[model samples]
Each structure stands twice: as C-alpha cells, then as structure tokens.
Target chain A: MLEKTGLPTDDDLKKVIPDKERLAKGAVVIIECFQKIPCDPCAISCQFGAIKPFKDINDLPQVDFNKCTGCGICISACPGLAIFVIDNNYSENKALIKLPYEMLPLPEKGKEVYALDRAGKIVSKAKVVRVQKIKNKTNIISISVHKNMAMKVRSIKVEDKKNEG
Target chain B: MKKTNLAIIGGGPAGLSAAICAASSGAKITLIDDSLELGGQLIKQTHKFFGSKKQFAGIRGIEIAKNLLQEIKKYKNIELIGNATVTGYYEDGILTIVQGSNGDIFIKLLPDRIIVATGASENMLTFVNNDLPGVYGAGAVQTLMNLYGVVPGNNVLMVGAGNIGLIVSYQLLQAGIKVEAIVEALPRIGGYLVHASKIRRLGVPIYTSHSLKEVYGNDGVEKAVISEINKDFEFIPGTEKELKVDTVCLAVGLSPLSDLLWQAGCQMKYIAELGGYVALRDDHMKSSLDNIYIAGDVAGIEEASSAMLEGKIAGLNAAVSLGYRVDNFLELNRNLRKELEELRANPLSEKVKIGLEKALLKREVDQ
Candidate 1:
C-alpha cells in the first residue's frame, strides 16, 4: 500500500515526465502529483494554460510542455510542493533545477551547496542560481548541478544548522 | 451582562471565518479564543493549503490567518476577544467565560445565536512510558517548533503515518530534528501519497503494520521499542527493534472536543466519522436545539478548508435566524456546500463520507 502511491516508482515518474527533447531545451515543468486530490492551483497559476484542468477535482493535473513557458509560477502554487522546473541546457556541463524551497535562510545565489537526489542523499555539488519568493512566503530556488543529475537532484543540503532559523 | 447578536467560540479557521461572514451580514459578532493569539492550528502551519481560491488555495495557513484577522478588523460590529476561555453554555444562549491574559476575569455573554467551533484534541497512544515528558502529541511539536521556534528534540520516534504524523515528521526535519522512524499500527500509511513522498524523499523510513511496544527513558523518553503486528494486531515476537531517541510524537488521530455542545443540551450521536460523540447538526449546521450551531472539528475531524466552508454556512444561517439578511444567501450556501463536496471527493475521505451519511440519517429519523 505504501509502494507506488507513497514513494512513486520509476514507472510512475516516467508517466509524469515531459518530453526528453523538450526538457533538454530548458524550461519544462515536472508535476509529480499521482493522487486524485481536489487541488488546482498549479493549473490556475499557468498564464499560458499549459496545465490542463481536471474533469473532476480529484483528477491529477496534466502539463503540456509545448505551451508551458515554465514561468515557474506553478512551482510556488503547488501546495504539495510536487511541481518543479528543470533547465537541462543551462550550460556546457550544468543543468538548472528549480524546486519549491520553504526553509529559512534561503540559500545564497552562487554559493556552492550539496545537491541531493530523490532520497535526499548528497549526490553532487551544485550552485544556487536564483531564489524567487512568491505569495505566502514560498521560495522557488533554481540551482545549477551537473547535467547528468538534472532529474536526480531534487533538493539542496544545508549543513550549517545554526543558520536555519 | 454583555449582549451581542451572535457569539462564536474558538478562533480557528472556522470561528474566524464565521465571525467575518456573520459580521458582514449586519450581525453583531463576538469571537472568543482561548489562546492569547488567534489562528488556532494555522499559526503553526507553515505549509501552503490546498483548495480553491475561495478557500485560499496556494496560500500558506499563517497568511490565511493573517488575512482573516485583517478582514475581521474591517467590520466594526465584530469584536474579537483573545485570552478568553468559554466555560459553559447555559439557559437561553447564555455563555460563561473567563477573559484575561491569565483568565482572572470572568464574564457572561447573552447572544441570540451561538456557534461552537472549539475544534478537536489529539488522540494519544497508550504504551509503556508513554506518560514521559518527552512523549509529546504532534500539535505540541508543531507549537514548539513552528510557533515558539524551539525544536522538540534531536532524535525523535514518530508514532503513526497519518497526515498529521507525516506532516509533523517533515516539519521536524525542517526544524533540524532527526526523525528516526515513523511506525504505523495499520497495514498502510493513512496520509496522502504526496505528503508521504515528501518525507520518504528525505530518507525517513515509514514502517506500516508496526506498533510501538514501549518507550523507555528516565526523566524523559530516551529510547523506543517497536515490533511488527499480525492480522489481529497482536505483537509478533522476535520482531522487536530498539530505536535510541529523545522524543516520541503521537499522531494517531484526533477526537472532536464537543463537550460544550453536549453540555448545552443538544442531541448527540456517536458517529466515528465525526470523531466520537458530537452534536447532531442539520444541513444548515444548526444543532437539534435552536440557536446552537456547530462547525469545524466540533462537527467532524476534517481539513481546515472544509472547516472554513462549514463556518461560512453556519455563520450565514445563524445570521438569518437572527433576522439579518445576507444577499443571495441560498446561492452562497449552495456554492459552499458544492465546494465542500468536491473537496471530500477523494478516496481518502470515504470514511468521513460514511460517518456524515450516518449522522444525516440519524438526524432525519429524529426529524
């Protein structure tokens, strides 16, 4: 019961991922919402109507990468913090991943930090590129990590505990 | 004796929204809360809420609380009294209360309509050494960390994998506290998959079909013992594992605190879905006894979004009963109910649906 639903499997992740070619072009959204819950902020947040509305309130939100300019509004709009924006064409060897970060002392731009994978384990070193604080104090942070870790890196590790507050 | 058109108990999402609505309807409203600060659980909820824009979706709970407070201030007819505890509801809608920073002052209010939204209390799990100081409820952990900015402990053992349990575990991590494990007695995690995934991605192991056997410590909880359970929920020997931790957070469930409703002589029914014996309410959220209404957790243990919708309905209905006219009242009520149904359409709320059905059936039989 805690299998695919709780921790989504690789197949579940595959179903929600956008086109590989489009993702590599930069600015594509990844929505990991698997359950049929009554939430639609992600759909409404999109100015370009990239996110499709649910026939039923419980239907999972679907994203069209073609229309999705990846304005990153949906990142902070998601209550579950499940939506993310990835730019695979950031640089020659780096890709940028923008994730919803609500923690204190937002990571400093250009500061190198430990990039973590889906399991939160340190996978690679990354540099913070941008931090955007939207409505309700939800911060959207874009970090540059190795191109290979684009999909793997989901969060940045803050080691210094004292600065958290 | 202080007089008002309506009196709302509890300063949570329900009461706050209700007060705002009733005041907007040209009703004199008096909102009372026990806490020095308002917002109930919203004050400690840093996470963004999920719902439509009407319910303030995409907004953090703290911000919603602030907006509600600001909105309430716009109406001069609405008076908010903090640091006030409602002690009793007596004859003819009279309310006995203790109001002061320390509750040293006493007063009685006579209001035409009363809305009880006292909310719910955390259900504690019974195990050896569970009474230790380190064994805290999930709400206590949130209040300590999010509200007071004090981390409960370094290493913690979470008991239950419900929404509250999972959310609190994630929050503890955000507060720099280490959650050793989340043990659930049930065969599966009871919370939403999204919430479970958030903590799982953080490397926190969630153990279903497992129960905490004992919590061992001297002055406080220093360690916890857990074991797997069989179909009958009996402990399976040789499956015991000891986890060294300083805190144990119980997030098993919550029971509605409906003592005020029960004492007010409203007909009560034991509806498990509504979280124990709660006052039976009609479609308008009015109690069996006229002039007494219920909303929020007092009606059932549901989400804050549902509570706000329920509060709006009750507030409008209470205002109407007091001869106050609200524009397009029926239309507004219908829309709120429709939104609530949409929110409860998820499979996770099936139990709540069943409970509500039973309560509605019982109410019909009485009618």
Candidate 2:
C-alpha cells in the first residue's frame, strides 16, 4: 500500500560505487532532467563512480562538484534526456556548460539565444559555442552555455518560442 | 494434420486460462506460443499487477505468469507447443504452426473447436532518428531486462505517457536504468494518475506538450532532442530541449495481430479504438466465420487479466457450440464472462470496450 503513493527516496545508492567526480576543485555542476520516469542509468553511468542513484531509479542524479572531471561522458550516456557538463573555469568570468541538443535548424555556431533554467526561466544570454548531432539522424545537438549561467541554465530557447512557423 | 477436442493458439494469459478452464471440464487442449517460453508478455512484466484477488492483484506479473504455467502442467490433456509460430489457418480447424528448428511440419488437426488468442504487437512511432539502435519498443526493453538481465540502455528517454510508457519507465528503474523523462504530446498524462504520481514524487518529470524531434548516437544512441508541440502536433522552435541519452524507448501504443483470423475468413472491421483490425466476435468470442474463435489481444489490445477471461469464454462456448454440452458448461461460462465484463468495466478499458461493441455487430449476425 505504501508503494502506491510514492517511492522511498534514497534507496538505490546504499552500496553503489561513485562514477562522476569533480576533476577540478569547486567546479560548478549542471544536471538536465527532461522527464520523470523510473530509471537510474545516470547514477550508474559514472565511472569515476562519482554519480549516485541514491535510492530509486526515478531519483534525479546528484553530482559531487568537487570531483566532477567535465569529461561529458554522462552527458551522452543519460537516456532520460538529462545530464550536462559545467566548467566554471571557462572565459574570464562566465561559466560554460555543454548540454545535449537534438533539435534542427541547427543553432549557428555564434547564434545567440536565451538560456533557461530547469523551469524554463531565462537565466541569461547563451551564445551557441558549438552545435553538432551525435550520430545518424539524431536530433541531440550539444550546446555550450555561459560559465555564470551554467549552474542555473538547463535548457535553451529563442525569445517568443513558437512552433516553427 | 492431427485431430483434437480443442486447439488454443498463443500460450499467454488468455490462451493458458482457456486451456485451464476447458481442461477442468474434461476436454483435451493444445496451446501454442511463439516464444520458447509459454508465459507470453507477462514474462517481460516485472511489476506486480493490480485487480481483484482472482485477477492476481499484488502479485508480480512474472510470478503470475509462472504460477499460471505451473497450474497448466497438472492438466494431463493440455498440450503446449512452445517456440511454434501459428503461420495461418485453413478451413474447418487446420492450424498451420511453423516451428523454428522443426521446420515446416504441417499438422492437420480437425479440432472440435478453435480458440485464437494471438495477442498484440507494439505500435510503431515515426520521428527523426526513430530507427536508431538505441531506440526500442518498450516490449523489447522488457525482453532485454526481465528476460535477459541487461539494461536496454544506460540513460533512457521514454516517449509517451500512456499506461504502457509509465509502467515501462517504472520497470526500467527496477532494472537500474535512468529514465530521463517521459514526453507526452498531450496536455495531460494519458495513463492512470496513480502511476504518474508515483514517478512524479521520485523526481522524474513529465514533459507534456513535448514531442521528440531527433535522436543522436554513434553505433547505437547517444542523445535525444525534444521540442514542445502545438495542438496540431508541430515542433515549437524555441521550446526544444536536448537530452543526452543512449536509448529512446517508445511506448506509444499497441495494435492487435489478427492475421490468423483474417486467414480463417472471419469478417473484420477497422476499429481504431480496439488497437487495429478486429475479428468480429460474439459474446462467446466466436468470429463471423463459423467454427473459428478469436480471443485476447488478437481480438483487441486489452490487458492480460481481461484476455484470460475472454479466453475462457471462447474456450467454453466453443466447447458447447461443438457439442460438448451447453447445459453443463453454461454456468461456468456465465461466470467467466461476468468476470471479463467486470475487468472491462474500468474506465481504462473504455476504448477497448467500444471496439468490442463495434466488433459485436458483425458477430451478432453469426450468432
């Protein structure tokens, strides 16, 4: 009956190994979660063993910023449309985060767009540093965001976002 | 060709149930399933089922399938052909089953009655990069994890918020995979609120009004991009979200596999609600073509619980129609039918029941 209401939090990583860790000390962390379903690939995908499932497969991945290497392997390994790489060391003051992108009309290398937070809230300006598809016919375009906005921005969108007219 | 008292095709819940009920009535039965194992789709189901006690509520689906198989073993008259595919059907009651290793061994059986519980297949969805290896049908994942003990992918994106999608997402978690999120083009979660709520509390987000635009991967899948869609189902330009993941699982829907019924010359109608083309069948599940019966998912993409009930209905009524004794089987058949009606009464089954009613019209003429 208890299982009917909700899942127990933090039950999946009791004895699990950590896969993702902070390679550079005090590096920023950015996690992109697309939807909610039962899964834990992200928690187990980290080889530095830095990531933790923590409990249920449905739980969101919590990263240890002190140990993250910014390798971005988990960025491509996550299936829920989640995971990203944040480098606070980018530029003079701005942070840079690489995210999974799968849309078309490929954002130009220098194109400017609004960086949005987890709730689609605009955090700051995001310049398209790089955009490329992962493989044959994949819409997953990886995008680079500003260093300062890296921790806050999890998504990208143009102003007055509308279905392609 | 071999002759028998009853011939049941597809050894899933529906077929097995019918075999059990009919065997209890002192009838010899032959059950066939395509999988080397007889449990059918239930084997891929790792979650516990919900329903009344008789329907196996609170029991894991795999355990339920195992229990059903174990019960069938006690029946001396029940013959199960695993790893055999029912290719087609001939006039009267000749079922052509093609066994993989055995080659084409044609068994011409003049059975007193026939029950076709062929079940359903996963509905395919079209999207850019949908054909990638990282993309899979929910059933395929179930097969890999539940049966093979390996995750379909590391991080996964599930498209569709229907019952199948939601249930599979939950099951994927059980197998220790990351379900990034579920994207539903619709405004509301199409599945039960309870299911949605379960995943929601665990921090999995549901992205409504979102549709997949593309998937990126090298040899398999590496990433997915989903964009918000308008009511008309077009991608929104500024609303795109890129998700890095290896696999994209589609649980869009299911459609009935009614080919054998068509081969038997049963009258059919395009009933979209029932998941696809359906063999018009009476309450007893006898199709328009005389001496042929259709039951379970093959009749419509209903749940295993209901399919089992329908199987019993077809088996029992087919027995009576073939001169097994109407007076003796009437009570048992009535109970089975009632159980089916209850299971079909849930709101979740409205679409299926509508399809059943549509299929009933053509069936009435045959009755």
Candidate 3:
C-alpha cells in the first residue's frame, strides 16, 4: 500500500506504534520506515540504547520502548524524514509532535498552521511550539495539535505572507 | 610526457576514493577531472546520503565530497589535474589529454595503471516541444539551483517518480518554486516511499501510471499535457490533463558514460539492468587489459556508496598489481568486498546484482 499510495497503511503504522501504556506516559519516537533499505543512521544517532543494534545495515530499526526517552535527536538525523516524536501528555486536550522540517521560512513559534495527515489532507489547526535548527539543514519543528489528532498530524503548512516569496 | 603509477579518470566519488586509497598505499596518482573543481555530481547534491556509517550515512553529498577532498590533501603522493579531459587511451599505453580554458594545452601521460571512473549522463525523453528552452534535465536543475543558487522557473512539471525526481521536487519547493505535479510511467512509484512521502506531504501530487503527453509554447514551455497510461504503457486517450508551467524537468534515468572504456577496447556488453554498456571486469575491477581498471557508474550504474567501495577495491588491487607493499592487502580487499556485498544485499539492489553477474569475469588460476 505504501508503494502505491506513497503513504504508510494502517497495518504498516500498527507495527511501529508504541503500546497505549507507553503513549500515555510521555514522548516517544515513531519510526515509519517500512522498507529494507541499507541505512542505519538512527541507531548511531540515538544517545540511549533504545534502537537496537543493526545486525545488518539493511535491517529495519528495532526500538526498545522501555529505554526510549524520545529526546528527538534522531528526528533530524534520518535522511528519509520518516522518524517522528509524539508526546500525548503535553496538555489535557493537546499533544506535541516533533517532525523533521527542511523547507525555508521556518514557521515562527506560537504561529497557527494547518496540520496535515499522511496523505497531506488538512486534519486540524496546530500551533508551532518549538523550532530547532540543527547544523544539518534538516531542522526539527514541534507542533501542538489536538490530542485526538496526535498520530494523524504528520506535517504543517504555514500561510504567512512572506511564504509567497 | 608525464608518468605516474596510477592514473584515475573522473574526479567524482569513485575517482577521489581511488586516488586516496592508491596514494596511501604508495602508488603515486594523477587524478584527472574535466571540471575546474572536483566532486562531479556530488557537489550539487543537497540531500543527505543513505548507507552505513562507514559510507558516511546521514551525511549530505556536498559534505562527503568535502571530506574526500580533505582526505586526498593528506596524501602527498597524489596529484590533482583539473580542467583537464582525458581524450584518448591508445593501445601503446599513452593517454592524450586536453587542458586549459580554451582547451589549447595538450599533454600525454604513460601511467603504469589506468582506472576509469567516468560517471553517467542523464537520459532525455521524447515528446512534443521537449527541445524548448525551459525544458531541463534533473542534474542541470540541481547544478543550477544547488550549485549556483539560481531558480529554474516559477512552476514546473517533473517527468519521473524516481529518487532524483522526488528529491528535486522537494528542492524546488525549498527554492520557492511551485511544482505542479510529477508523472511516472510505472504503476508503482520507482523511488523510495520516504522520498515520495516527503514531497507528497508538501502537496506535490505524484501520478503513477502516467506519462507526459506533450509540452506546448512559443519560445519556452508555457504548459504541459500528461495522460494516464495502461500496463503496456499505452496512453489513455481521454485521460489527458493540462498543467500550466514554465519549466519541465526530466529525471527519467541515466546511462553510463563508458566512451573511454569502449575506446580502450575492454570487452563490453549492453546490460539494460545496468543502465547501458559496461566494461567486463573481475571482482578486483580489472578490465580485460592487465593494467586497465574500471569503477563507479562507468563499470555499472549504482549508488555513490557502492561506487566508493568499488573504487577502493580497484585502487588497492591496481596498486598491488604494481608490486606496492601493502601488509594487509588481502584483508583489506576482503573487507571492501564484504562491505560492497552488504550494501547490495537488499531487494532494491536486485537489478544491480543481476547486472553484475553478467559483467563479472572469472579470474584465471595462473595470474
């Protein structure tokens, strides 16, 4: 389904999502990479021993949820931009999602934007909470969305006037 | 006439790695490239590479080129020749080169060993008005935007769903250009899903099982027509759709630039899976001729990581053939081979594996 639609199917997402108990706790990393490509940067970038060591470079990353602190260091390190950090305990009705953003005109903090789902459909309105520009061009942007839309919102679109430039 | 132990043609990732490996093992090297600066296509790639850590996984291609150049600088035995083109390689072991701004300078080299690492050229598609001024290859677009910071056009239609097409679309957005859509002839997206997802979430629609019907304009591209295709690649008559765009980028595929190998008379075969004609070589990358070596896209179309690994193998083997004293030669050679095997072990590399099987020549028992 991912090959045809370019978006992971529910079955694909089911394999990588943390259990309900883990989600209720705090922030955790979600790797949406389902292919067997020859890459292992996530394991190397993780400070904690959450991502298991890759027996072969082509092996998919195996994350140990117990050790995962969801520091979000691996978000920008992924070349595919397939990794994300979800914090369900952000607020009573809001959740925070950290994603890799490489586009220009970085969204200003506290600015409202349209949050999009996997297929790029507008799902909800979100506010930018954090924008960390790393040494690499892949910057990390965290947005606070409705708690029910935490897993669905994967990207944000800013409608600033300057973006027309 | 100038002479060296090993002469590397094309200063891309493969050639740079070859020069560094051979030079470190005491084989004086002359690394030649047509561009004034080195790094070939890598200098223009903005996206990070995907491979193991040893191959610099998660590092941008531009940074990888920088690291290779810095590593090459450490080898005093290595000499770099820029703005120089290797014109011909004669049977008598002489290579003619043309250098200088006007290409008026002529030079000859009689190196003991020659490694051909010439890369690839982008393939163009056939369609009405494809020759318009606004039409461009993906590589040209990358060179223009990433290298010179020049945006190609306001709106564009990409003609492939491969990694290059997807990545270039993302880059165009970064450059503030609007991507109308992407059309691919295949039913399923040919590139990695992650790359497709990256662009899709940004609102660029990819039309699989679709082909560019035509482009129409007076002096430049003003609009494009695309239509859905069937399993046999036949265009569906009523499925045509028009998109207004100033530029059309073709990222269909690439063919190996193996003219030097053909001139050298190394046994060659046309392998569609490999992207074109490639030189038949052994595991060490030695061509039919004892002193001739081949690597990178010239040997077979593959990723930069595999190309770098092949370069190391070819460089070390070429040096060893010249009696260079490398204490751990066998061990290093085995490790490089293992790494290359691991890199190509995935299902994505199935085509490359099939191509290699046909191009790989068996080594004789008596060297």
TM-score of chain B of each: 0.97, 0.94, 0.98
i-RMSD values for every candidate model:
2.1, 12.8, 1.0
Cα lDDT computed for each candidate against the true fold: 0.87, 0.70, 0.92
Question: A158, model 1: CA deviation in Å?
Answer: 2.6
Runs in model 2 deviating more than 4 A are: A1-165, B102-106, B325-328, B362-367
DockQ-based CAPRI category assigned to the predicted complex of candidate 2: incorrect
Candidate 3 per-residue C-alpha lDDT over B255-353 given as tens digits, one digit per residue, 9 for 90 to 100: 999998899899999999899999999999999888899989988888898999999999999999999988799999999999999999888899889
| DockQ of candidate model 2 | 0.02
- How far residue A65's Cα lies from its native spot in candidate 3, in Å, is 1.7
Worst 10 residues of 3 chain A by lDDT: A156-165
What digit string (tens of lDDT, one per residue) describes model 1 on residues A20-127? Answer: 889877888999888777788988889988998767677789888899887789888888888889888889988889998877667888888888777667898999
- Compute DockQ for each candidate against the true complex: 0.53, 0.02, 0.77
- Per-residue error for B223 in candidate 1, Å, reads 1.0
**Cα lDDT tens digits for candidate 2, B152-269:** 8889999998878888887776555778988988766776554564455334678888888898877878889999998999888998889989999998888888888788888888
Which pairs clash (backbone N, Cα, C closer than 3 Å) in model 3? none
